[model samples]
Target: MTDIPLSTWAAMAEIIGAGSIITGLLVVLFQIRQFRVQQRNAVAINLAQTFYSPDLAQALSLMQNVPDGISLAEIRARGPEYEQAAITVCTSFETMGLLVHEKIAPMGLVLDLAGGIVSTMSRKLARWQEDLREEQQQPSWGEWFEWLGDQARAIKHEQPPAHIRLDQGAGGS
Candidate 1:
């Protein structure tokens, strides 16, 4: 047998509206997180495809077979075949670095895929890369390769790789 005051009704409406706004914001944040996860997964899939490409596979094979710190002169003596393989591998790592910097690709996944490969290649090619930089008179060249190596070294992992964990997520990442 009582009627609520007009101001009380208005206050109640305001509280309900605030709750609704908070709920909406929460939803937006969740969706953004999910979108990032999906993007990371897509990037990982794209990376896998890149790895399986004929040229890339060949380049990777060459990289693995090459001894650490192999001299530029030796690589040149082996001829353009080795040169082309190094080019392919380094360029690929450069692209991966860009993706990681842009956050389009997950850092963890990038490291997981071939962290050691990149690190080792970058180290092996350090002298050659510097030579190219001097030859071109552009010190900025191959910065991406170095950047990717640094990113890879910065990540710490134990047991299975991060990509495996991402793939095994309850949902499709």
Candidate 2:
């Protein structure tokens, strides 16, 4: 200690300071990566809801209202408005082998699963934003509203076209 001069002490302090800066930068990078992954997962779940869930709901609704003995032709005739989206949905389900009653059983189950995914993602995002707010010591209202706007945009952009006319008008056009 006696041999060390004031210059050495200054240099040591600078090194420690630089080390801390590097550590902070690394933490920021890790956090950014984690956020990106979360956002991607959310987007993917949203895409699934857009492309699959609505159609599944419509199909299920149609199946429920149709008399067990009704002809497909009659059903189609009654559902002319839904022809395009319905056909697309039917084809998509057929390709995925999900159109069969035995396979799909309860469409509600599929919708419930999708809903759970969306709910979980929402909770995670809220928690993340809450943490960010706490860390930054700032109110989160603005960020929350912005996030909501983004979600609305995503839903608006991705929602499938209305299809499958329910006799009771269960599926809104």
Candidate 3:
């Protein structure tokens, strides 16, 4: 066999080196995408856990009887427990709202999970939230919670309930 020229060998080596670099970069890009998906899934799981925690469940149970447009004074008049329940609910929604707003959690997932509850609770606590904000002189108080509630309400209006949406057996096995 004839010997290869040095210049030709150098060109072939450069092509191989470039191909290796491109392959490594593609691998890195894929890994980055996978990492992002894992991170988002982890966040979603944590949010779900928080939503279903015993404390939140208990708070929701307590607040279930709260009338729509309940006032802060009325909540305080009922007892400290009611007020505490309201705080728990508001803070939980606030966290969820912040997460959604920051895009750390997707809106579709959050709304699918707790949109109804958020809308209902927000309506029930609207007055109380406003009163608390005024009383505390903190305009940002419960801001995210209200935002989340608004988002939930808007989505609720725009889409049918899940049962209805799934009535067509879109995901039936």
> Which candidate has the highest TM-score of all?
3
Model 1: ten consecutive residues of lowest lDDT: 153-162
lDDT of 2 by residue, 117-169 (tens): 32223332344334435756877423423343344345434644234224336
Top lDDT: which candidate number? Answer: 3
After superposition, the stretches of candidate 2 with alpha carbons farther than 4 Å from their true spots are: 55-80, 83-173
Q: How well does candidate 1 score on lDDT at residue 93?
A: 90
The number of clashing residue pairs in each candidate reads 0, 0, 0
Q: All candidates' TM-scores?
A: 0.76, 0.35, 0.94
Error of 3 at 29 (Å): 0.9
How high is the lDDT of residue 67 in model 2?
42
Residue 84's lDDT within candidate 1 is 88
For candidate 3, give the lDDT of residue 96. Answer: 94
Worst 10 residues of 3 by lDDT: 164-173
Give per-residue CA lDDT, model 1, range 48-95, as digits (tens): 788888997887777677776666677787889887888888898999
lDDT of each: 0.80, 0.46, 0.94
Please list the Cα RMSD from the true structure of every candidate, rounded to 1 decimal place.
5.6, 19.4, 1.9
Superposition TM-score, candidate 3 onto the true structure? 0.94
